[model samples]
Target: MVETLKSWRKRWLSCGDTENLFRDNPSNQMQGVMQLKATNSGMPMKVAQRIDVSKFMSYIKVSRTQLNHIKRLKQSGDGIQTKHVSRVIGGLDKSHVKPYGALLEDEQRRLREHWLEMSCNDLPAAFEVLRERKVLMEKSIKLLGLELQQKNVSVLRKVRCDLSFNSFS
Candidate 1:
């Protein structure tokens, strides 16, 4: 199941304030967030007793304000369901659904093998393929140049014939 900020806070906060440090950073802020390893260190609290009421009150006030705001926005709606919006919407939107079926194990293996074969696994062979492609490209370019030259010559011949004929006239 996906973890949300409220759930995460509940989970870690339930463990006690001594074990976790919630910061203002995005990963620790409102909404569902993953448990941060840095903040959620299982090590014994070094400054548990040092926590002042002012600091605790500030956190509580901030959380209460956010909760109230969200409740107002949601107004009469269920408060923050754990399921994603797409899941809640059900099959009405097929956009999230996969277009194709999952591949069979044998087909997946075959594709992997084909990809390995196509990849530059053998350097010498890959270089040879590149060289062949370069040669073919050069040959095609030369052929195109020859064809262009022939067309130019034909056009020049026609122009010369027209000039001569017009001169005689």
Candidate 2:
């Protein structure tokens, strides 16, 4: 019985070339490879990947005020919901069913107008503006769950930068 158990254990533990296991299953194989790489490097498992919000905003032409509203929402300890965040940041103007959609749409229109009028010569500054806008959008999404309308208004009152920077240098 002892010898039989030992033999079974060795067979189960052996890392042999099992072509059918991974080769036949693409997703499983990729997962196996990722697990192997992660373990070998002693890296912590990454729960979420970093999104390049700037690139996404540029593609969608999301406005700065819209971004600021999102940020204010997030900072007030409102948990960001993925659906609303996606809608606001990605330019999918879905009816939110909540009262906030009308207010958000009004602000978004102003931002669109602002973007149309602005021109920047400095690439880095322009990139920063885009980056900041993305940050605000992300934060706003985070805030959506935490604050009431009055709280949202108070939180948003503070983010009063022009967003239009004329670089002297």
Candidate 3:
């Protein structure tokens, strides 16, 4: 058991942890990529590939600390303002940034980057906007159809009334 633990520690230190973890956990890998992009907006994946893992880890540590502080304050019934949460989560990207900054091969990095670009313009917000727009368009079309149906019903009622009066006369 001790030897297994030691081997795992060594593997983690040598930067083998990320591949082993992310290979099976696509959700975690995606979160890491999202956090990287959030922290450094408009940063190309090629640039992200060159990021210093130690520095990235340091930033994640600090950001996580700040977030914990905010969480503690909120739990203690302290009047933690939105500014505090935003400062840690939005400004630091602490909420989304996962600890998976190991170096990847060029081909892997390129493939991930290409997938991100093709699917979402490199940001999830773009996909969200498209989805929302589609929903709104569908709603509007349905509403218009309902309005037309109502108008036809009213006209039919009026025509029936006229035909009855003429037949009686």
Candidate 4:
């Protein structure tokens, strides 16, 4: 219907659409967040709250409550990277100051301020898994070839033995 098309377009064009079509769509929300974050000033509370809800679109989605937790490290103070907000934290914190580092707990983290800015959302986890699978498949194929060769050799030996015995007979 014409109404459906209009609603769809509104959702695509602006985050403030009244129909709320994008409320459940995380990707769209992520985009809205990015746009809002890029403004010269901080985003209005309404926009920040909408982007926060997007944190739930996927299993890894980060909720609005947790947004500020990571903000401590961001230089721009815009928002967390989309992928980093996933269900799990998934890795060591990017900070260089470890527990053994000479810096105090608070001071150590500040040391990583620059690195945190560099840490925004991006993921290679899934690709790394696929890479491992490819390696395993290659190894399996090689072993299968060796087994086939051994079987062929054994069969040839049996045939040769039979041929010599039949000749004598």
Candidate 5:
């Protein structure tokens, strides 16, 4: 019993008693990415925030692969395999794609740039371009609303119609 206790103590000390007791430290620590300096009275101040494009690209690649897999599964009529689909979807959900939200912003910025380059007389033509590209969907209903507002026709009246059958009378 004494020998066993001694052996246990030796093992504990050799392994560092608190090592496994603590949670694993996050790999992406801010200090490693950013340089901090002490301001007045020893307060740490962040100098800059850096964006690692390669990391972002890796995330994009993973998301694209998952999306392609889902699409292929759908096309092949093997969608009944819910486990694979769920795993892919879940992985995508946890990915950085949703958090970034920059894709739509970039598209909108490009469209705005294209619109601004055109003359006032070309406003309709610009809208036509957007429509042709299928970029103007229900999400852009406000644009349609503005167009409708500018027209002399009453949108509400056009939508409302009476249906009646006189055969019974």
Candidate 6:
């Protein structure tokens, strides 16, 4: 299951001080943490006697207040001897897809120029594709302009109300 800070603190602190927790605690902290004892040291572990709290604090990366809080948790000794927790990674966001902007501006410009040149030279038969695209774009622009003009005329006609009332006697 996903472990939160509170749960982590509870589990870690419950391991019962660096004395009981870190003695044979080769599982969780084995990677970067200092192993104070050889599990095979054959000498049974001791706590609070040898570990200078100041030096210990440096290794654990917590403030005195936090350490005191941790000290208060019950040393329930759950999976204290158990080791190895698997990590979970979430799905990638759009940022991860093009993290560095796909290509630099100068490179992108050069690429576009190269692509245009290649298509015109190598694919001469496909010249109609470009021509068709240009034609369609021009047609869309003209249609939009005409629609805008018609809307403006209708709006103006509505705004200028010519109310000529005639009476038949």
Task: Please provide TM-scores, in order, for all candidate models, with all chains considered together.
Answer: 0.31, 0.22, 0.29, 0.29, 0.23, 0.24
Model 5: clashing residue pairs? Answer: none
lDDT, candidate 4, 1-169, per-residue tens: 3544676687677766566655688996676567655662554554456446544432323345655655653555765675654422434343232332222435567767755655542235556788999999999999999999999999999999999999999
What count of clashes does model 4 give? 3
Kindly report which residue stretches of model 2 are placed more than 4 angstroms away from their true locations once superposed: 1-59, 83-169
lDDT of each: 0.59, 0.61, 0.69, 0.61, 0.59, 0.53
Q: After the best TM-score superposition of candidate 5, give how far the Cα of residue 133 lies from its true spot, in angstroms.
A: 28
- lDDT tens readout by residue for model 5, 1-169: 3544675477677675566532334453343223332223376666544354423543233567878878888888655487777677675557555323365566689888887766555777878888876754764887888887867356554444222233334
lDDT (Cα, 0-100) at 122 in candidate 3: 40
lDDT for model 5, on a 0 to 1 scale? Answer: 0.59
Alpha-carbon runs more than 4 Å astray in model 3: 1-123
Q: Which stretches of candidate 1 lie over 4 Å from their true place?
A: 1-121
Model 3: lDDT of residue 116: 78
Task: Give per-residue CA lDDT, model 3, range 1-169, as digits (tens).
Answer: 3544675587678775585732666786577667765777755565444356445552233456776887786887768887876766565543444454432344489888899787776467777899999999999999999999999999999999999999999
Q: Please give, for residues 29-145, the per-residue lDDT of candidate 2 as tens digits.
A: 577667666667875666543343322332234468768867876786867777667756653454233334445577799888777656444566788999999999989977875
| lDDT value, residue 137 of candidate 4 | 100
Which candidate gets the maximum TM-score versus the true structure? Answer: 1
Query: Which residue pairs in model 1 clash with each other?
Result: 4-32, 5-31, 5-32, 5-33
Candidate 3: which pairs clash?
none
- Note the clash tally of each candidate: 4, 8, 0, 3, 0, 0
Q: What shift in Å separates residue 111 of candidate 5 from its native position after superposition?
A: 3.6
Regions of candidate 4 where Cα sits further than 4 Å from its true position = 1-122
- What CA RMSD would you report for each candidate? 21.3, 28.3, 26.6, 21.0, 19.7, 24.8
1-169 per-residue lDDT for model 6 (tens digits): 1233455577686776755644555565654233334334667666764335433332212346544544443254443221211111112331123322323444699899999988878677567788898999999999999999999999877666443222321
